[model samples]
Target: MSGELRIIPVTGLAEIEEGDDLAELVAAKLELENGDVLVLAQKIVSKSEGRVIALAGIEPSEEAREIAGDDEDPRRIEVILREAARVVRVRPPLVIAETTHGFICASAGVDASNAPEPEMLVLLPHDPDASARRIRDRIRELTGREVAVLVTDSFGRPWRQGTIDVALGASGLEVMRDLRGTRDPVGYELHSTMIAVADEIASAAELVMGKLDGVPAAVVRGLEVAGDGRALDLVIPEERDLFR
Candidate 1:
């Protein structure tokens, strides 16, 4: 596949809410083929599963209050704290945390942007991998086509200046492609050349699914990748983690 990959954005999806059938919505909009990879924004998944919270409904803990300081909203901080396993870094603008799912992201993958209400906050889907699997299986049952699903969220990198989409959970797709021991063009052996395929697909799909465009899902085609792996495979083990 040397030409170009095709990314088709699934547009006109109504505002997702709790109990919405996301698999049906996506299957109705796009004609999925075998090996097609669907990348869905995490916000829609969170909304569909009622993972949103009203800041007014929460009470701040002492740790949350201390972590937030004076300007920040203590209730929001409390929610972040509840979602996080440990605080990675604390700054006025943001709080980076290691989520219970082993994901390191700002505010424990919580989001206020595009929230249904002004006082509401959207949190990452509880058990995102399970969510992905369910969605994938539903789509297959509906369309009778084998497909992959990836739950994605925009995340700020440590050294990078801007945000990019990354895979939070995946099903029926290979998250990483390890190319170690493979020979290069000149027959030279390669080592430690693992590629984050799910993240790449997520970021590429984002090019078509704008942040505020109301497009929640995208289909990535024309790539030749096959495996039975989970998004957890993308995480760096604690023992090998260089960055704390």
Candidate 2:
């Protein structure tokens, strides 16, 4: 019999801060097992690592001022500029940036919602894949149970309304399943079929961990994938960017 998939949210976590033991905090709340995948919201991970930045500390440059126009905050634009590898588009309230890590998002993933202070903004992890590995290793060391970890952030799709969680970092699981050269059930040779499993897991977990529900982490059980895969594998390189 196929195992039933379960997405269980772990609640009751205290507010995270820089230098906090995220693995310890998560383990204390959830009992993880082998084959389980822990999906963590990028916000909590950013908080735990002290990625929060004070808007007051930022000094907007002339370029930042020119991009922000009159109504938007220049300091926020400064932060986004610093985080972005390239500015894709600038339309005042919406600055689309390709992050240094190759993520294309609005405001370079510099978020202000749910910050510790009203004057603070949370930035993405300096190295999200490394962060996922650290969390996975720590959880394994503490519980003796092997599992995967995935960091997720919400992103808007082109031409699509609203947003959903997507994988920013991952460890100990296959992020993509490449099915090229395989034969289909109908006996036809399959080519160019790949699945982004990590992103799908993140999206599924988001169903329970809503935007304002205060849930930070969730356990995805019954997935059979086992490997040493990173979320970077999910990224489509610029050379292969059909949209570009």
TM-score between candidate 2 and the true structure: 0.97
- What lDDT would candidate 2 get against the real structure? 0.91
Output the number of the lDDT-best candidate. Answer: 2
Model 1 over residues 1-244: C-alpha lDDT tens digits? 3757899999989999999999999988879999889999999999999999999879899988887788888889999989999999988648999999999999999888989999899999988889999999999889899898999999899888999999998999778888899999999988789999899999999999989889989999988666677887788999999997
User: Deviation in angstroms for 189 in model 1?
Assistant: 1.1
Q: Which stretches of candidate 1 lie over 4 Å from their true place?
A: 1-3
Q: Write the per-residue lDDT of candidate 2 for residues 33-53, one digit (tens) a residue.
A: 998999999999999998999
* TM-score to native of every candidate shown: 0.97, 0.97
Query: Where does candidate 2 clash, by residue pair?
Result: none
Candidate 2 stretches with Cα past 4 Å from truth are none
lDDT scores for all predictions?
0.90, 0.91
